[model samples]
Target: MSKSVRLLNGSSLCSGRLEVKSDQTWSSVCEADFDQQDAEVVCRELGCGPPSVLQGALYGEGEAPMWTKEFQCGGHESALLDCRSSDSDRNTCSSGRAAGLTCSDPVRLVGGASRCAGRLEMKLGEWTPVDGYRWTLETAAVICEHLNCGSAVSVGKRKEASRRSVWSIESDCIQSGSLLRECATPDHGDSILNLACSVPNCRWRC
Candidate 1:
């Protein structure tokens, strides 16, 4: 069972390599099977808002017995230990590629019905796609700001079908205040990422 959790090597408490304390020692979780859903639990466990950003091995890995138990959290678990898990026994997904997390801030917007709502396309020169998962107040705030949407109390996630491939982003955004165009993002060179955002009041005028 995971007893405690914390972020390591990140510039701030809101980001870093995912590590869990169990049996009195610190260990890293497997990153291959991890995603935004799993990341939501980490931020919530740390009292941070929804996960705004994610990166694999962004902190340069870790030493460990390597946690093989895959975590299943609904993005609301008070503690990481309370979430369910089972042994996966992975080898390719090791500590050298530990996971990294960042809270949301001003994000890139591509397509949607309103200025505030649409599919996220962060790559600078061209548009790309992103994944949809549980979002928190903080994360939603960033997206709204990027789109000039009023400060909304809540945000909802929607799904879509895009023929494009997922953007291959392997780095954490440099700053919370900075949006996608400012960052160095490489294209997956395929299709849209598929995550959608919807906000209230600021309907698309154009």
Candidate 2:
């Protein structure tokens, strides 16, 4: 079995069901009581990248008590515990209703004119290009969505003239619900992924 890290219940240190501490006890957070700003603070506290996915019940509900106060973060707090709170308006929180969040793993698109278009790279211990093996629109969409660049518009393989070291992205693991960063492993490949995402203010090129 996996061990708990920090204040959240999750598989990785940065992705998991939202939980908070109050009065020397930890409790799960209700989805209604959490928001994007709250999520940002949690990610920052955990030393992860920006918030990627925020969904209720992405991780199983915990047996711990539910937090009774609503968080009020302004999106710039250094830590979740430092934010202000108010009496929770929620009367009850049922099972599978706890807030679950996935913080991004410092993934980015580069070498292109726009933030949404370029070769894919991820930062584990360091920034490394991603091997495009078995990469599809579905898998590429994960990166685009994490970057808040909307959906994936296109995915194509780019073969560099010279083979280089890269991180191999496991499509099966990702399709099975693992985050892209969690599924990446160090490997070498001849080709990398080129992606174009659809941003709200950009055309198909982005």
Candidate 3:
């Protein structure tokens, strides 16, 4: 019998079984590609840590094939198994894509006791920090704007200093209407924060 389980519709292969340790406890596969250049793609898909150690047959081979050959992919590996296969290639196996993924910790948003001096820290997620900039008041305002929090009450620097920088802001306005502009500024150095916007209820950190 096939030890693998069939994923439901809208279920992702990354949501399927991943072999951690040496036993078969059904772990979620981290996104990491077999090839060096494509490893980051795996990290982006599983929503986990960064691809530090990429192992092909680390735990062991899977029970079945999750994907086809000709695995040309962008950095996004979430859609790896869903990609169309090469018709001309017949020697390939219909097994799962050979990958290993580890996402960096997520970015955490620490609410301030006073609401004006909140902070953001890197947590466990699929995001990374870029150099050359720090979060600012206008960035906080942008986050509030996306959340429909009216206007940003404050924005301040975080105490912890690392490759990743953090900042905090406050707002009461909630997103009710369509956004006039996606970001406060398009310039690279504008320092405007980008956040996901949801109608009715704003997901500030998203």
Candidate 4:
């Protein structure tokens, strides 16, 4: 059997048993209010699928510490034994805490260009310019996707009259498709100039 599962408050669950395979070692985990939700969290953290089973009392109660409680989870627990504060203390079963996640995938472009630059004229994807006319590294990366690029390496902002101007001077090694000289902006915001491979492309409204 493995060591007891210690809670954040230093309490331990020693009732039933949990079969866990870690480092090639098959050990038993103490069952408490632990449920499918907690199991799901464990699986996701370990890059596994969702948990479909929640055994209680270790099938017959193992040796040493015995579980004090059994919890019923919604199968969306964030961590092992992550239940409500009330249930966290009680030896009863209830729904567990759900895990929240945020992720981003890298985008791949077609052609290979070490650097590409364009003026900031519109917002797309997760990039939003500041003050309706400014661009930043974070915003530039979002714009790169529109050009089918990997990411933005550099960003330059220029202000002219009432229009706030921005420019991405470097493509950061994103592939370009057919040297897009002209691109129509999603809205009638501002006109932008795109330069690829040291050549200037047609200007379009973004």
The lDDT values for all models are 0.59, 0.80, 0.35, 0.35
Q: Which stretches of candidate 4 lie over 4 Å from their true place?
A: 1-16, 19-32, 57-60, 67-77, 81-206
Which rank order by lDDT, best down to worst? 2, 1, 4, 3
In Å, residue 181's CA in model 1 sits off its true spot by: 27
Task: Give per-candidate clash totals.
Answer: 6, 1, 29, 10
- The deviation in Å at residue 185 for candidate 4 is 43
Query: Please, what is the TM-score per model?
Result: 0.48, 0.59, 0.32, 0.24
Look at candidate 3 and tell me the lDDT of residue 15.
25
lDDT by residue for model 1 (1-206), tens = 12498887775566788888888888787676567778887776665556866887777777755776778776677787788776655656743567777754324555655555555655333444654443455655555554556553544444445334444433245326433434434433423333334454534432
List the candidate 2 regions with Cα displacement exceeding 4 Å. 1-17, 20-25, 28-47, 51-102, 201-206
State which candidate, 2 or 4, has the greater TM-score: 2
Task: Please identify which of the two predictions, 2 or 4, would achieve the higher lDDT against the true structure.
Answer: 2
Residue pairs in collision within model 1? 105-142, 129-193, 130-193, 164-191, 165-190, 165-191
Over the full model, what C-alpha lDDT does candidate 4 score relative to the true structure?
A: 0.35
TM-score of 2: 0.59
Which candidate should be chosen as best, given lDDT against the real structure?
2
Summarize candidate 3's per-residue lDDT along 1-206 as a digit string, tens digits: 12332221111222223332213444333233234334444445444334444554443446543332344556554533443334653344324443433333233233544222234333223222222145444545544542344465554432223233322122222132212121112222213233222223334322
Model 3 residue runs over 4 Å out of place are 1-37, 76-78, 81-87, 90-98, 107-120, 123-206
